[model samples]
Target: MTALSLEERFRTGDPRALARAITLAESGLDAARPLLRAARELAAARGAAGTVVLGVTGSPGSGKSTLTDALISHLRSEGKRVAVLAVDPSSPYSGGAILGDRIRMLRHHGDSGVFVRSLASRGALGGLSARTMQVLALLEGAGFDWVILETVGVGQSEVDVAAACDHTLLVVTPAGGDGVQAFKAGIMEIADVIAVNKADLPGADRTVRELLAAQGLGAHDASTWFAPVRRTVAAKGEGIGPLVEAVLAHRAYLGAGGLHARRAARAEFEVRTLVQERVLRRARELSGDLYARVARGELDADAAADALLAGA
Candidate 1:
């Protein structure tokens, strides 16, 4: 249909319109600018200050997808309309999501209140699609009470999710050596809530202790938010209640002022990232000959970069 009709339908929270809007958004900033502008205006008009955007990230094999599935079930049970943006690694050849949406989250297939979409990371080092923030705005404008961003779980570089969501959940498994690795990766510092999934396994209690000890190492005052470490057997839906409660508590801790600050930071990040992307695109367009010159030793790498920027 026409763009105006699509925007109208999206304003009414039509699921089909939301899906189409996300697809258009993924295309690129220029292709989706009008629609995204509309979404931003709608969100501002609605004063969607309480919208919950949760970012779930962790190392690979941390049961992140299963945890997300369980989270969807819990939120749905609580009568919240939820939308999930699952970022999967891109297939090198096809540039498509390697793990498609249909394969996971199968039970929510027919749920009108829930929307699940898989995005190809497209080789983004941050483990999220380049256009993820734009698509999230569309979801928010479409009236989803909660939006969940499940990243590619690429260990060290997955920290970008913290800037994109209101709260970040880091999932780890017992006996997986995650305590040390997460510390080294700096993911621990970014997590607002930590979940030890597969808690029924051996060494679960030890893992919990290790996390608590790690938290102790960081200096904190009365105002500090000590990220709660919760145990969960997500596959069996065990301990999901406490995990959900922890997230809600964290949200409460943020309050309206804190949430607004975080959202403002996110908007700044989004704008900065878009500017960088556009500049890089322009650099690539102008640097073809500069690259050849550098390869031929006719110009130094730094000089080539200077020329590129000058041209930009």
Candidate 2:
């Protein structure tokens, strides 16, 4: 289908169209470029459904996926249509997702209101797959009422992408040694809500206390925002409701802060990142022979960098 037609169906709540559009958006640039550009323009005009974009991030095996699943169920049961974008690390040689998020969400497959997408990190430097943002736009444009973006990375880069969402929920487990410390300094800075998963475990309270203490160290600029930590037994669906409520509250807080304007700014940033990646990827692809000359000392690094900039 044409981009316009696909977008029309997607807006009308056609699940298949949304899946196809996202698939096209994830694949090669030549085939998906026109559609994505058109979608981007349309999104600029129509904008997001004012959907609450909630992000969940943490170290692998922190019960993030499980917590995400519980949260989706909670939202769905409340009559909200949900969209999930799960970033999975790629197998270096196979170039496929290490964790099959779609399979993990199999229980929701039969539900039309829940759309799940598993995206492999396409060797994107910052842990986020390059096209993940575009795919997010596609999902948002497809009429989802609540969108959840889950990242696989545990570092600063993951924190960066999670910031794009309205409320970022950082998942941490008690079992991971120094997990509380891992959160307090870097990744936790961006969290609007923190979930200490495996709350049924013995050390969960200690972990929560540590996070609270670390949070106390940061000067809460009342003018800005504050992060709140909540304990959750995701496997048992213990705290999903409170988590969802916190997400809604954060949405209200951000909306009052003029979130629409912030989203526009974020869109601008995403566009720049996309363009930069494209240019750099193209330079690498087209400058093979020139780089061979460089390897033979025929061209220097500065000259090559300058040449790439000139083309850009």
Candidate 3:
């Protein structure tokens, strides 16, 4: 018997095939480029349904995984097919994911409707996989209604998740001012919603008030959609319902046109980043003697860049 194509397997929502397609996408430029093209074409042909990409990011002890589990339960209860990409810290030696997110979300294993994947950051800055956008496209093409991207617990510079997602949910805990600092206006301008997780803990209300005050003080237009802060005890499943409503409200706020605009912006960023990365990869694959020459001042920096671009 012949093997099924990636497109066919993905269209049928075959978990194994989805995993392989993501793996193929993770491979370097030469191997990944064609697969991405074919995958996009196939996605278009399959009438790929719109999937909401929710970015969940925060500090390490913010209960992000538990909150994800709670959100998954809430979404699944609504009959949505959810696919989660949990971006984890990569082992520097082997370039493998730590797999903590997958292990933490282990309860969903029996459910075919819930597909959870763990991805190694693999030295990608900003707690996102370089191929995250592609993987999300694949999952949506496979007909998942919601694609949740859980980033590695983040700091200020981990802003790439903003570009890759339609709606960013910044998860923070009630750790006095630490949670507030992570959701500050400038670095996390992409966040549309905030969740104060571990809300049952002390200082939870204080955290919520601070977030509300921050939102008010933010430079964004109050005439438009303001980021709503919600509280959740994810481990105990408290307040998930309200959090779901807030997310749904944001989705509704997007409407058709807003969603299109967001997707276009995401594509633009993805394409530009991919081009730069591919060129750099190709240049690095070329003779190191070129770099050596530049270093030795045989060529000016601009000239070296031009030569590399041309060679790439």
Candidate 4:
């Protein structure tokens, strides 16, 4: 389709067109740069403040899909036009997602008020597809009030995804074992809210207490409303309401002033990353066999480094 038609489709909230637009946006700069820049400019001109981007991240099998389904239902029941973008790890062998969360979220399929899309991480290491934020903007411009970004729980990348959102919720299970320790050092710090999934399990309370003690982020606070530890049996939809409330409250908290700063930072970060990618692409285009020569010891490594750095 033509650019205008594609843009119109995105504006009209056509899922097929949204998928195509995002694909173009992800397939490197040549295909996406101009359109993405124009889209951002349009967003600025229209003064379309983004929807509440809620990022949910945690360990694998943490029941994130179930939680997202319940959360989406809750938001829809509240008359919110919601969008769920679940980012799954691309298959290492086939480079496609093995499990599509959109299928699992089909409970809202008949509700035009709710939209769900699944994105493959596409071998992107940071738990974030480079096009994620742009796609989110597209969704907001389509009039979605709430956008939930669900990520595969894979350490640093998941943390990066969480940092890109207005509010970050972490889902964990009671028997996380040593996984909790890793979170303390990394993911837990970025969480605005935490939920212990499978709360019906034996040691649910203990897990919550451990998380609180580990992160010092308790429920009662004034400075930075401490991350609340909610219990949810997502399969049964228990405690999902409180989870949704926490997400909304966090959005309000961030929107007051923090949202602007955070979004600005995310925008700057994306720009820098794109610039870096462009520079590397150009360098590779110019270098050709020179890199191979250096690797094969036909050229001095230091000299190659110097030459590449000079070109950069």
Q: For this target, which candidate reaches the highest TM-score against the unseen true structure?
A: 1
RMSD of each: 2.9, 3.5, 3.4, 4.1
Could you give candidate 3's per-residue lDDT for residues 123-215 as a string of tens digits? 333334457777776676666778888866644224767777778887888875655676553644566888888888889889888777766
Candidate 4 runs further than 4 Å off: 1-20, 27-50, 89-96, 100-102, 121-126, 217-222, 283-306, 309-312
Q: What is the per-residue lDDT of model 1 for residues 44-89, given as tens digits with 9 covering 90 to 100? A: 5655354688899888778888999999899899999888988765
Between candidates 1 and 3, name the one with more favorable lDDT. 1
Clash statistics: count for each candidate: 0, 0, 0, 1
Worst 10 residues of 2 by lDDT: 40-49
lDDT of 2 at 123: 36
Give one digit per residue, the lDDT tens place, for model 2 in 1-312. Answer: 555576566656577776787787777456556556655565555543467777887777788888989888888889999989887653445655656544778899899888887777553455455577778877766657888988665554455566456678888888864356665457778778888899898788888888888877777677666666788998788999888877777776766445677667667756766777777787977686888888999889899888888887
Worst 10 residues of 3 by lDDT: 121-130
The best candidate by lDDT is: 1
lDDT of each: 0.79, 0.73, 0.72, 0.72
Provide TM-scores for the models: 0.89, 0.85, 0.84, 0.81
Instruction: Rate residue 255 of model 2 by lDDT.
Output: 60
Question: What is the full ranking by lDDT, best candidate first?
Answer: 1, 2, 3, 4
lDDT of 4 by residue, 113-189 (tens): 88887777543344465577677666655557787888777755576666567788888888755237645567777
Of 1 and 2, the candidate ahead on TM-score is 1
